[model samples]
Target: MTVGPKARRSGLPARDRRVTTRRVREDQRERSVRADVPTGGGDVGVATDAEAARVQEREALRLAHRVVDLAEDRKASDIVLLAVAGMTTLTDYFVICSGGSERQLGAIAEGISEGLKQDGYLPIGREGSPDAHWLLLDFGAVIVHVMAWPERDYYGLEKLWSEAPLLLRIQ
Candidate 1:
């Protein structure tokens, strides 16, 4: 029946009346609740660790597809996209493509890099030279291999990582 500040002071035990650390924490938790916060179930604002990882994986897959499209634009031949997340810890996706000649290889590499950079993606590292006839552009989650027909056939990356699923191929 009594419910004012003075009435609230009338308590049973000293232990119940005093504001302990645990009691203060409980009071803060109660006060922090708002319409935006869930009272019981469901999460809000931030994603869980597993969900975040899956989101990152989806981003990597998207990037891989973008690379494929860019390579196709530049007339790359024998394009193959491989999902290597389960097979390798190095990268999530592998984009293997072949060009007719060394000059074509460089164009494929440049086209992929410039196109991705425009969309806010950059290569972490680049490997091989024009003379080598093999170019590798590493973009963190996704890696691109630009090779001449002979080298691509010689290495046989698709055969090497045979366990990985082939997401796409344009021959």
Candidate 2:
């Protein structure tokens, strides 16, 4: 088969040429859309989503540590801080701790919630009952899990997120 000079030079069939042109146009359109969207950095012109996410993750980890401190102060046991930012998109950090009893678990949860609240941060949602074996506090970028010793042992959150790096652990 004989090919024309232009077709031979371009090295693509007519159908492929059309598809390539369309793909280029689509890419241009996507770049335009991304150009208009503001990065979450607040007043810093433009940044990649990954950059913004890193900033958020740092802040979330800081808050997670604070929660750990509060729980420890309240005498929560076996506190663990997991850096889940690289493992999951759910939250940047998971502050998991065990309390000896339901009452102690409730006290730990309340201490963390109120302590962060005093810092002008409020949980987005709270689940599990304070009277139950497990209490979860969701703070958008961070999640706190206060569980009874038996619940913590049964759930094994640390094992579940075993791949996540352990940022802090207090026995």
Candidate 3:
């Protein structure tokens, strides 16, 4: 005599026959792994976009200080950091400073450029010269402008980039 399917299964008892919730979850997890489901950053466990941004910003702040230190070392007359609303694509912060004369301005600009380089940031562009009244350094996330006192007064960049956040002001 052959035992029926239900009768044979019932011999094991209902409690033993049921699958545990933990086992079901494990099966689903295994299936997900086999399917190559997205876990955001894959196996290496890298930072997400927001975390990366925070790190970038922190680095930028460090660079900014380095630039300031270089300027101070080179004897720049005044240093200002502006968070202009819309001036350039790179930095949320703008560093503007002045020197006693055209020659001083050029030296200050050069020093800031070098300092930024030490921090692993390079200026995309620069303008003006020692003979001219002003010099500009355009790092991707921070822009530094060095100008002679007279030129700074005449151009009034602070007024031009009026919408900026105004992080620092020094005369």
Give the best candidate by lDDT: 1
lDDT of 1 by residue, 16-60 (tens): 545443464344223223223322367554555555565577778
Better TM-score candidate (1, 2)? 1
Q: Residue 8: error of model 1 in Å?
A: 71
lDDT of 2: 0.78
**lDDT tens digits, residues 71-131, model 3?**
8889886788776526665565778888887778878887887776776555666777878
* Backbone N/Cα/C clashes per model: 0, 0, 3
lDDT for each residue of candidate 2 in 8-116, tens digit (9 for 90 to 100): 5568887776677666544422332323235455564554666545555556667888898999999999999988877876777899998888888889999999999
Q: Comparing candidate 1 with candidate 3, which one achieves the higher TM-score?
A: 1
Could you tell me every candidate's TM-score relative to the true structure?
Answer: 0.74, 0.70, 0.66
For model 3, what is the error of residue 44's alpha carbon versus the real structure, in angstroms, after optimal superposition? 8.1
Residue 161 in model 1: shift from native, Å?
0.5
Top candidate, metric TM-score: 1
Ranking by lDDT: 1, 2, 3
- C-alpha RMSD by candidate, in order: 20.0, 17.0, 24.6
Backbone clashes in model 3, listed as residue pairs? 83-165, 84-164, 91-141
